[model samples]
Target: MEELFNLTYKDEVEILKDEDDFEALGDEKYLNHPDMEARLYWAFCRPNGSCEAQIKDIDPLVSIMAFNHSKLNALKRFTLLHKEVIENPNLRVKIKNRTRMLFRSLVDDDFKELNKVLDIVPVFLEVAVDQLKNGRKWNDIFADEIEATIFMQKAEKFIDDSFKEALFFKLKDLRELDQEELKEHLEEIIEKKEKIHTLILKHYKNEVDKWIEKSNLHLLQKMTIKKLAEKLI
Candidate 1:
């Protein structure tokens, strides 16, 4: 079961060898003792460190690090995970499910910590597109219509125009499913896709309006905006 492989904060701490034991001494003392924690953090973070070599599978570790205890810590871990995922083909394969799960969590959480590391959003978006292209289930990609619409509102700016087009096209394809398949929570999928489509269009229109206002063009500006919409959508 996936739960068997899932790691919690406690599970991650235990993997630090003596972290749990050290923490049991006292919360204050454990918090003050940075040397040991620093060493362990580095051990786990470093690409060539012993921890990396010892852990044959990094899926759970990556998942835990993605949504770490604090925004700052998660930002740091995300930077390292991004590097590893980009540099190591093996890591990319191992991290696929966990990465999708991270996206789902971010959506469900309304992207609370995403502003801390906006640059990393693109990689998550890329992973999402990869999953969709590989025929991953809709539920695996998003929590539900409400959570997904929140994502469209908050995280849509980070999504590239091409990615939006691909997502829209795919969602449209999903909508075309027959009535037989519609019985299985397909309506939720339909609602999610429709909301996302509308949000994207609204974003595009708002962007064009802002551009037009900034450029201070008259009738010709409207023509330029039309061209821009043609290119963007």
Candidate 2:
């Protein structure tokens, strides 16, 4: 985590390198391609680039960094993207896609760590709702249709994992209570669980059109609550 705090933009390329053969862990290999900066620029700037082209160009490095390095490193990248968007609000759509890549690469444990470090869901929701209310089109929410779909899928997984983790911890706590305490807390426990379920269901993407119109904007914000610190700034 300390290392993440000290990471400057100048070192981003080095950190993204496939040093130590970390990319060979999975079935697919992520070769450390050269001219990474140029690829990144094109990925984010090309007006007519294919969604596959944009994601494929950088996902290998983002994946290795998120899964192999540390969750904090992912947060760092996400925050940096947020800063980029802040500096150039026009890049919001493009940068959002890249940040969601980091979000998708993270596991349940990484999400937990992110929540601990920074609760970013509310901030994202606020921004989303504000933008929609200001007339930002649904199609403009992400870089493209494919990215929107992928991001929503990852959001659903995050919601499911969060609900299960909450339930497990709640049950564990209940087990430690005395019989009398358990009896007294039964209603409270049920209420808490129901609340979690309700929150999860609220973002369950019943329909994209319906979700976008929902005033609360509690959409995919829950997926990377930790990494969204600068996302909407």
Candidate 3:
């Protein structure tokens, strides 16, 4: 097993080195390379000859290699070519599994780095629902007020005097909540506390729409509007 692992690692390294050489020779040479053609085919072509894998088990280095060797047109092509892979149920499951494993491995010092990539709105909603149901305050569940505010802006529809007072008291205590545990709690909230759903959806729709417009997120705008309309049912 050790020898096999080493061999696989060496192969990966060679592929990366070859990719660098191909890239330096200009786009024409890179595009004409037999190895590039083979790698693209293997990465994209479906096992059953039906559809390509949008998300492959290939290393990130290989993906970066492809990116460096090609232009935006190539990147766009690669992205579109793998759409089916990304949409595949098995691939999504694998992605989720890997993501959970990675999240679990994060240390205390890694939280800042993790937060940069995480879309905290959903996480905040999960936590907020838990706090509201348990009659807890935001400060009781979060360590940072700025983080709490960001969460509130994304998830909360109304911040009344009572809620503010409760949050203020909790802030003094400085407690922390697990995001995943909060998600599980939110499932219960969805079933037993339907009113919160309306509030959450309302908040999500209002804030996300404004954000999409400001950011010029045309695709997200269309999707969010469609979802908002569907929520009426």
Runs in model 1 deviating more than 4 A are 1-76, 111-118, 129-233
lDDT string, candidate 3, 1-233, tens digits: 24434444335334544454533322332223345433543333222221112122143322333333332322242343233334454533433433333333221121232333234213323334334334322222322333434444554564665545443443312113233333343343334433333434343334434443544346754564445434432
Question: Which ten contiguous residues of candidate 3 have the minimum total lDDT?
Answer: 45-54
The positional error of residue 227 in candidate 1, measured at the CA in angstroms, is 26
lDDT per residue for candidate 2 within 88-202, as digits (tens), equals 5454444454344443333223134333223433234323222222322222111222222233333453434543343232222322444345334433333444333333222
lDDT of each: 0.42, 0.34, 0.35
Candidate with top TM-score is 1
Q: lDDT of candidate 1?
A: 0.42
Clashing pairs in 3: 54-82, 54-85
Ranked by TM-score from best down, the candidates are: 1, 2, 3
Angstrom error at residue 104, model 2: 3.5
* TM-scores, one per candidate: 0.30, 0.25, 0.25
Q: What is the descending lDDT order?
A: 1, 3, 2
